[model samples]
Target: MADHVRTVLGPVAPDALGRTSIHEHLLTLLDHVAYTPVETPEGRELGEQPVSLATRWYVRQQWVGVRDNLRLDSEAVATAEVARFRAAGGGAIADPTTDGIARDPAALARISRATGVHVVMGAGYYVHRSHPEWLEAASEEEIAERIVRDLQEGAAGTPVRAGFIGEVGCSWPMTDRERKSLRAAGRAQRATGAPLMVHPGRHPDAPAEIVRELDAVGADLSRTTIAHTERTLPSPAAIVELARTGVRPSIDCFGLETAYYPLAPFVRMPNDGGRLAIVEALLDAGLGERTLIAQDICQKHRLTAYGGHGYDHLIRDIPVMLEAAGRGDAVEQLLVANPAAWLAW
Candidate 1:
């Protein structure tokens, strides 16, 4: 690991991390989601539907209470949220809120102190949709300099170097600008010796190509993880190939079914099973040690009335699913061993 980076959880020596969710947004401002408009006419129409009085009242109450109380800028609230996670038995959480979306590093430090939970913060820029326009015009070397600065100098001037590289990639097809940004991100990773956590494109090949790109830039694949792979149902062979090459393939999406509530008019159940099937197949392929699971739960509404899925889900529900699948040890690997090793850098 580089001198600038420090794990908020202190030393994540082997077996020190217990129950970690590698991909999650602890406190997103919801600004990024706003940039990507609904493309289809029907989608836009649905989005514009007038809120029912009941729904309106609910939204208002949530906004007044939870949303207002949990703003990432508030150090006190961030500390409280970390306490909540610890109370629920979580040991560590990787907050992949990078660059523009990421908030104060001092706030993270305070939260770590208050809650006694290890927090690994991120250092790269976000995708094109979320990034500022100036970023798109910058040269790869310039972008790489910014990322390196974050890792070398603590983010927002905090003393801790960012513990990880991304949520760097985006969901859309890789554009020339995105490719340039990725190359820059890779260069930063190489310079800092920090692991890269990519937000792979929605396609399966996206991760494979990303790994290749990182390798070309001389980044260490053994320390990198391709995240949000839940949508990319890559073949088991392909997944194994990534693992063999030293990249950890993260299937982080777990409880996002609510996002598709009421379902699109054309979508159906069989397709819903696709994500779960990928999880099963990956486990069957013996990729358990290289896999990490998380809810990627970010929206303010997804958290309980008090706070987001809080922490009980990881301590309880996830273990139940693992047991049911006859892969109980796999859960330990993800929540404990894998993160410790990967984050140890």
Candidate 2:
């Protein structure tokens, strides 16, 4: 039965999932026009000098390549990325670039074939602001049916359906539209038995609200992951509480702290040690098995430069951090055994 919902790489073998980055993006070209280009006079006036120069150069290049290569060659790029990951002894990645911006499954299959990395795709709407207009009018049951169909059938006409439920439903203050989407997503999780992943809002109260909403809808907390909980300063007690209810807390937004900037470095989680400290605290509190970690690096420009960290960081750095902090065994449990048990693959 799981075959219907699994990717081309069915029942990912233990050996296959060498080191997984469970939440990341394979392709994204966010509406760059929504904000002024970094090079524009208005951007310059705002003192975003570095960004302005970068944006101007990016836009110029995009224009020049508009006719030749407007859209990203996702298959080729993903294949190459997977090759690099494999070379680094990495195994699997979950491309949580759900609807609106996610690339085609055919592309995913191509990359999987070329590079031998297990690629898990996602199904569900993005943030409320980015969602398609029709979703505003759709019924919860209708949304659930759509999500179930994607899990049961496949995304983008492939025989392989998506393996998970999100990167879904975000709003700074948990807006009505996002709430509706969350309810629908919960309904989908209930129907498909797929793990529901969330992109929680930036507010501190966001994690509690998300867990509450999912609980209210009869979603299996055990199978749910609150992704990027690292963004908000969630109380250690709050994280433990969620874990007590069987939900997994994830600090999946590694290495891309630059995206959150000034707000992130300051948003420490109640203790003195920063985000990593919080994970340690969660482990100490008896919820280590319910924790997961990843680097949610997205964006074409970032990957095109600097070799992009490749996805082997978890297998490489996690043990070192844990050992340095005197918790080596905990690292093995969290990074390896925990993810396997949670996904039930």
Candidate 3:
């Protein structure tokens, strides 16, 4: 058996994990379902919800796409979706919803067993807003020790150990709390030998700052992946610069093409076509081997159950896209070899 990756089902050889989705959310429970819909990319109505129960129910019903649309709680639904990925020849997924997002390790284990997809769970706290109150009082060493336990033992008092250290949440102008989490995550990464996946705040400069902080903590750059460059850093040159640092830059938003979030001024969301141009730039910069890709499917609209492009969108569509663009040779590295190398222990 391959010892490169430890799936929820158990350890597997690297070659067994064919066409892995490096960063995705097979399940996400944002503290028992909560979200404030933005009227526009500017988030014009930035206020608190009414305290009345009737108004809360009314908001949830009215804002279907914006609110209460993220709860992927049905195991049967999740199982069917993973079956779709398997039908498309996908063999694994890296689910990065950690404590802040109600990560269900047991559910992940069930889904992996039912669907036969190698599911790799993540370990670490998320963004400042998603952190549990106890995390604020915990020291960096304490948090790092907890992650080590999650990796070496199991997570959420279950027997499913995490295979990676992220997607550690960070925003533009990293907060002190996020910085502390990053330091703790870096230390845990060193201790456990699991690769790190990062979610940079939707800013072009956020990844660079993340690299600086992780470096200060003695984290290995080569084992770190900066995710969502397609949404955050729109500039190919900027993506290339991060790749040059010996860190992997994940252009993982393959099918997402919207400006629904309030990130217009900071980032103009790119479609798959636009992301292709960025990938071309990385290849030209001789950083192809350091790049990774995924769909980052956190919302309901992005899933096949909801009519959006499923997890197989990239695996099925990108090859035709690459062959049409004269970049067919780049497919294997992005889809197979790189993820296998990055995810392997």
Over 65-157, each residue of candidate 1 has an lDDT whose tens digit, in order, gives 223222334455456655766777788888888766655566666677777777888877667666757786799899888888876676666
Candidate 3 lDDT tens digits, 65-103:
244355656678788888899899898999998987879
Local accuracy of candidate 2 as per-residue lDDT tens digits, 1-345: 332225555556544465667786665544421233335565344332222334544433232122111223355675676677778666677777766754577777777888887778888887765676778898888877887887778776667778888877677788787888888889889876788898888787787788889889999888899887766645666666666767888877554433323223355423113557768878888888788887765544334332334456556666677788888878657665665565543
Error of 3 at 269 (Å): 1.0
Query: Which of the predicted structures, 2 or 3, would earn the higher TM-score when compared with the native?
Result: 3
Which runs in model 2 stand beyond 4 Å of their true positions?
Answer: 1-5, 13-16, 32-74, 234-238, 257-273, 301-304
Q: Which is the leading candidate under lDDT?
A: 3
Best by TM-score: 3
For each candidate in turn, the TM-score is: 0.79, 0.82, 0.90
A best-first ranking of the candidates according to their TM-score comes to: 3, 2, 1
- Measured with C-alpha atoms, the lDDT of residue 120 in candidate 1 is 83
Name the regions of candidate 1 deviating beyond 4 angstroms.
1-5, 8-14, 35-81, 234-245, 259-277, 306-308
Candidate 1 structure, TM-score to reference: 0.79
Worst 10 residues of 2 by lDDT: 62-71
